[model samples]
Structure formats: C-alpha cells, structure tokens
Target: MTRQILLLSVMSLWALCGATHVKADHYRLEFPGMDNVLPIASRPANASRIFYAVMFDAGSTGTRIHVYTFIQKQQGELPILDNEMFQSVKPGLSAFADTPEMGGDTVRQLLKVAKRTVPRLEWKRTPVVLRATAGLRLLPEQKAQALLEQVREVFDESPFFVPNNSVSIMDGTNEGILAWVTVNFLTGHLYSDSKNTVGILDLGGGSTQITFLPRSKKTIEAAPADHVAKFDMFNTTYELYTHSYLGNGLKAARLAALGALGAEGLEWQVFSSSCLPRKFREDWSFGGVTYKISGVVDGYTGFKPCYEEMLKVVQGIVHQPQELKGSSVFYAFSYYFDRAVDAGLIDGTQGGMVEVRDFRKRAKEVCNKMSKLRTVSPFLCMDMTYITCLLKEGFGFKESTVLQLTKKVNNVETSWALGATFDHLRNLNIH
Candidate 1:
C-alpha cells in the first residue's frame, strides 16, 4: 500500500510541472481600433523573448504599416518596431470588387517582405491589423460591404491565421473623427492645451473636413465625481465643430470645371499626365507671350468666377457675415503651378516674351488677376447668411466665430491638408 501511494504522488508531481511549462510559454496579442492591421510575433532565441504587434494604415493614395513590440516592463505599451510606407496611383473600385482576395494578397506581399527581412520573427504567432481608409469609405454601401467581405476571406488564408475576434471595419464617422483627432494631435492644436482654440481645415483627395475646438482655460476649480469628467466638457464647455464636404477634391475640381466649360462650349486641351486636367492645359497668350497652364483645374467656374463662388461659400460658412467682405484672399494654387513648371512640363514664354521666366512669375501673374477681380466685383457683397448657417451647423461654432475663421486659398494642400489635425488628435489620445 505504501509503494502504490508513492507511485501516484510521483505521477501527480510530473503533471503539475508540465502544466507550468506550458503556461509559461503562453502570450496574448491585442489590436486597438478597427481600421488597422495588427501583427504580433515572438522571438524565441533571444535571452529575453520579444513579441511584436504591427498596424497598417491603408489609405486611398498610400499604404503605411507600422510595427510595434510589446514591452512587458512598460505595461504592454507597443512601441514602433519598423515603419513602412508606399504610395500608388489610386486603384479602381472595380478591381477590388472583382478580386476580394487582392487586398489580402497585397498585405501578404508586404508581410512576406517584412518577415524575410526580420528572420527571427515567429510567423505562427504574429497577429496583423488591417484598416482601410478613404478608398473603402468612398465606395457605395453595397460595394463597400462586398469589398470588406472579400478582405476577410483573403485575410483568413494568410499564414498567420486571424482569430474570429481579430478583425473589424471602422464606421465612417469614427474614421473621420479619428482622422481629425490624429491631425489635431500632431499639429499642437489639440484643445487639451488651455490656449486659444484653433480651427482646423482638412482637404483630402476626395473630401474635406473642417473642425473647431474650444480653447481650454487653466483656471479650474472642483474635482469631478467621475474621472472621465476631468477631460469631458459639460454643456458649458466649448464644443468641436466639423464640416465634411464630399466630392470636393482634385477629381471633383476637374469634373466641376469640365461641367462649367461644357456649358460655354469651350474645351481646354488635355495633358498626357493624369494629374493635369484638360481645362488647365489650354494655351494662353499674354503680353506677347504664350503659356501652357499646368496643374489640375484649381476651381470650378474658371479662375475669377470660381474665386467669387468660393468667397460666397466661405462667407456663408463664417460666423460674422461682413468680416470677409474686404479681407485679403490668399491664393494657394501658385505653389502647385510653380511645381509643375519646375518639373519642366510647360513653357511660360512660348508667345515670344523677351525674357524666359520661371513658373513662380507666371503663377504670381495669375493670382494678381484673380485678386483684382475679387476686389472689383459688384456681386461680391451679397449676404452670406446661408454660408454662416452652414458653418454653424457643420462646425458647431457660433456664427460670429465662424466668420472670424474664414480664409481663402488658391490651392487645397496649403489651405487644409489633414496632417496637422491628425497630429493634434494623436497628442489628445483621440487616435
């Protein structure tokens, strides 16, 4: 009886030891937000085993994938391991529709390259997060749904199998908010700082978003009962106002320009480069010099007409109706046109000017003309009441404040790219 008891005790001890070994090797992976891919991996040979988590930002014009490693000492904060970025011409929606697996295939190609470079990574345990941005959101609802379903199907076939809980599609509003937040955080314009509230204008390739945040004041008093309340502003707090205008990017600019010119029975010669539109390529002569216009047709209804139209749009969106009446309008298109000339695509002195001048000189001439028209136009003084209402509704700002924030630009990038806003949001932890 004693020998039998000893044998049983020995078996029980071995079982417990094996269990401990298995538990010690276990690890967990996490991904935040639905729009990104998270990749996780383990390094077995190192003295202190390391695990990595990666996220991919799949945008319409480019793809950015950032890898991060879990730091146990830092309470699992994932630090960047490797960041990769690639830009491609916008792909057609039909392409993704026909091959749902293409999205996964593209991801796999990227991962394959990453893994090959980092040979120590354990492929079996890696978890990847994939998120699509403007490209997916621009699609019609049925098309977007189909595209997502295809992405899921392909992602499942990857070497690193995704658990059922590992994937999601971010809602459009959330994506817009997060993108707005990210830009705000990076530009030092987040409302968390008790300085003057900053207004943000973001012009993307397909859409534009305008946001406003209330300035934080440092002179506070009582502690809130809820911890979250410290950051929360009650109804008394200044709120963020945002306006997202759809179909207003470069492509839209071209379409609107074409529509306007078509009504007038005029057509500008098209340029070979996809970036340059037909109307902008028309040959023009001034002061005995002929010049070829480059860059996308900047605004609808031609230069002067479009400028007036935009002013009305801006006036309507501002808080004070009269503030913009005589304000200086800054032209943003000059830079874009200057770049095109620098690239040697167009000649500015073809009409036989005595001296050949750079693109800047030509752009300056164009801007001067537009500015003169804005100053002299009789129709420029119309009431901006409608625009003011839009500004109030879109950005949640008082009508007066909206008027104060109104500014004009000749180009979209200089006026309202979302990069700055994205930065601000990151700092505020909205991303």
Candidate 2:
C-alpha cells in the first residue's frame, strides 16, 4: 500500500470553513478546536476500513445533506468514496431568521436522512457538519447567529458525532477554492501528470466565485493582493487566483440591476427594467427580504435595452483574468448550468459544454424573445444578459472562451460541498 501524508495548507480560508491538520495518521483541527473528537476508528482491529461523514450545506436557495460513505484502502492513505446519499429541503435556513427554531427543524429533518444512510453502530463514530454560505452571511449579525445557534442545538440532539464549531458561515474566498478543488479532483486533473487544472466558475444565488491556477506570471504579479492566494497541497505549494463577488450572482444581480439593492423601502419605489415582460409586475423574495419589481408597461424592450441595463451591473466590477482567453479550460456550474438549460442551450440531466460566445448568442435570443412575448423564465432575459456581460465586460473574457457546462462529473456532484467534505478526509495525494 502506498502511504500518503495530509498536511495543513494556508489559513486564510479558516475564517470561512475553519481549519484542519493531520500528522502521523492523527487528525488535528485547530480553528474549531476539534481535539478529542471522533478519531479514525480502529474497532475492527484494522485501522483501514469503511467510514461515514455527513455534510449539510445551508445555502441561500436550500439546505442539502451529503451523506458520504468511504472505504479506507489502507492506513495513512486517502479513503475511497463508496457512495453519497444526497437530499435537500427548500427556502434555505436564512428564510427562517425570524423563526430560528424552524431553521433548526430543517436541520433535524435532514439528520433523519443521515440517520438512515449511516449504519446505527457507526453513528457514534461518524462526524456531522453544517456550513452556511452567502445566505447567512447576508443576514444581520444577530439574525444569522440565532439561526446558527438553532442548528447547533439540533446537531447536539442527533446521534452522530458532532464536532466543535459544527455549524458556521463560510467565507466567499474559500467557496471559490473549494469549488475549484472539487471540479479538478472529479475530473482527474489532480491525479494526472499534466501541469494544467481546470478553472471553476460558480454562480450561486447570492454570490459568484472564480478560481483557477494562473498560468501567466502576469496574472499573479499584476493582480490585487487579496485575489492571489497560495496554499500547500499534493506535496507542493500552489499559487492560485480566486475571488468571490458578493451580490453579483444571478439572483442578487437582478436586484442590483433593478436598483432595489439596499433600497430604503420595498414598496416606496417599484423597480422597472427593460429586461422584464412589458406587463410584468411582481414581488420577489431573496435573502429573507421582499421587493416589488416590474418591467416598463409601455416602452421599447429587447436585446439592446436589456444588455445596456445588465452592463451597468457588471461593467467595471469584475476583474479579468490575465490569460484565460487563450488556451484555458473552465467549468461553469450552478446558475450557469440552470440558465443554459432554461434557454434550451443545454439539457438539465446531461449538461453539455458551451463556448463563451454561445452564452452571448443565446442571451440575444432570450432577450429578443422577451421583448416580443413571455418566455419560460420571466427573468430569462436579465439572467442571460447578466451572465453574458459578467463574463465579457466583467471578467474580461473574450467571446472565444470555452466553458464546460456541467452539474456533475463522474456521477459525483461538482459542487463546493464535495470539496468541503474532502477537507475532513484530508485532500488526498493522488498516486
């Protein structure tokens, strides 16, 4: 059996996802102080065997549980994932800010799935964790804390092993890196002998993230200090460029483009835009707040007007990568996959890849369609236009950039949750 050593990396993301370290087959997590927690079980007289972990993602749109089952191939080596039982509940934990107990109940409900997935005898040995993202981070400090406290209580009542700082909000920066790790890991980029790794573009409801190992020295030298990060992994140190833009996701970007973000009163001013149906008017909810938004009742609307409005939301906000335009591969998921599916650009179950110009071409079609009549999504025009501008004007990508649109790779979810869980097992050194 080949031996592997999992060591501590950089500590910047610890504020978001906490920190973990391992030595001599013993795990030590500092930020959460997970000392004396569930150690690798030696019950069967073999330190190498099966193990289970439960991860809950309390995201802006929903709360999801990934009950991961793994088999330790050998001592001091990475565990092989046997299976993952995934399930989710809607409205997100942030929606229950005013009713925290209900938020706790949602967690308790998901724990039932964990209870069934993980064998009863292994219950006491399995560790369960929950990490909230942009949703809770957007809430008032008090409300977010209340919701977290509620989840902690729920975790305590469960039979599974719960660690210190079991529930908390994740940093936007870490979110990007984790997503990058997940895609690269699933695609075998981490295991191959190639010097390249695929980039990741995640568009969530409240935030969007971009991460990639920069091939250009200029990308690292000329970029903002905060955007460049270095971490140790795979027995080597890696320097990457990553960042998460808050309030720039598909949903939040709508509020921003509509001029409703941080607005004083919801009903005082009804935000009207050219991206909506001419007679469309409705109230939308996001991050626990509601707003009255509509489209112009009588005026011109189409790709031209919509693109102009969407441009304001991302014209100068996004920082372009120094070298992605030439010969780089990227995987764009979440809202990217969904919107492409909605626009008939790709299928939901079998997500197909698309070039950067493809999004532009589709955005024009969707926007022009909206200008004439209603399409499948009322927000289709705005969403597509935002993605288009966000990639081109915002991120400085050329229309030729190729982005592989996918929800899963190798039958595993290509989400940050997978990378987040890999943290617990230690990012394995690929043989």
Best by TM-score: 2
Each model's lDDT: 0.34, 0.78
Winning model by lDDT: 2
**Which lDDT tens digits does candidate 1 get at residues 185-242?**
3232333224343444443434444444423221111211110111121112333433
**TM-score of each candidate structure, all chains considered together:** 0.46, 0.88
lDDT of 2 at 284: 87
Q: What C-alpha RMSD separates each model from the true structure?
A: 17.0, 6.0
Model 2 CA deviation exceeding 4 Å by range = 1-37, 40-42, 46-48, 74-78, 192-194, 371-375, 427-431
* lDDT by residue for model 2 (1-431), tens: 11111112112222122323466455332323223556645465555567788989888888999888766444434445557788989888988989999999989998999988988989988989899988888889999999999999998988888877778898888788878877876666663235478999999888899999988899998888878876655445668899989889888899998999888877677999998988788788888788998888878787788888888988778888768667788999999999999899999999997888899999888877774546347899889888998998888888888889999775667788878876654532221
What is the lDDT for 148 in model 2? Answer: 95
Against the correct fold, how does model 2 do in TM-score?
A: 0.88
Overall local distance difference test of candidate 2: 0.78
Clashing pairs in 2: 16-171
